[model samples]
Target: MADITGIPPQSIDPDQALWPNAGTIRSSNQTNAAGQAGNAEKPTANNKDGIYVKDRLEDKDVKPEKIIFSNKLEASTYLKLQQLATYGGENIQEILEAALTAYFVGKEEASRPLPPKVLAVLRKKYPFL
Candidate 1:
């Protein structure tokens, strides 16, 4: 998956061209247009630059499986959330999940106390319902 470009085919030695059209290997004294000695580093599997296709593919595989979750919050609320995260030694996402879960649970418990018909009957029995 390595690719090298900008080399003329005829200049490559037959034995050194391990495969057809492999990149040129310059003699020690040869200089590129920049006048730098032709000591260009060869791309390798462990190179961090990802100049080769395989290196880029491997990088993709090694990346963390996380997605960006963006939202806007009031300044005060955002500050409170950040403080809670710092004090509790947990992340904002965890705190938000717990808070939302508790809120829904409270709503469910409130609903469990009475059906609408029963509440209406109670309201009729006591005007101050």
Candidate 2:
């Protein structure tokens, strides 16, 4: 389609096409150019450093600024999650929260004090441990 200035759409500059972050999303915080946002669910409080932080689990309804990248596996997982949410008649955000909670719970468990046997093996394998 022709734009108002009668310029036809063309491919992005070749140099930009191969740039490392070409497909990466940028947040407004990274730029001096004032940006605008639309009606996303609002976020909660901010720290003295001006970053938003949700203090309560109930604040899940409040949207926060973030970015995520996906490959085939992650994209497939999200698609399956979306399907499950549709089948269960639930919001995708709630499903996402459940998934995040499960992931973190595993992480927390993995962080607990290791058994003496495991620690001995690890320490033997890597003296820095």
Report every candidate's CA lDDT: 0.52, 0.52
* lDDT per residue as tens, model 2, 47-75: 66454553343433233333232335577
**Where does model 1 exceed 4 Å of error?**
1-68, 106-129
Residue-pair clashes per prediction, in order, are 0, 0
TM-score for each model: 0.29, 0.28
Tens-digit lDDT track for model 1 on 54-127? 33444332223433246899999988876565455455555776886788884767557678899899767655
Cα miss at 114, model 2 (Å)? Answer: 21
Which 10-residue window in model 1 sums to the lowest lDDT? Answer: 21-30
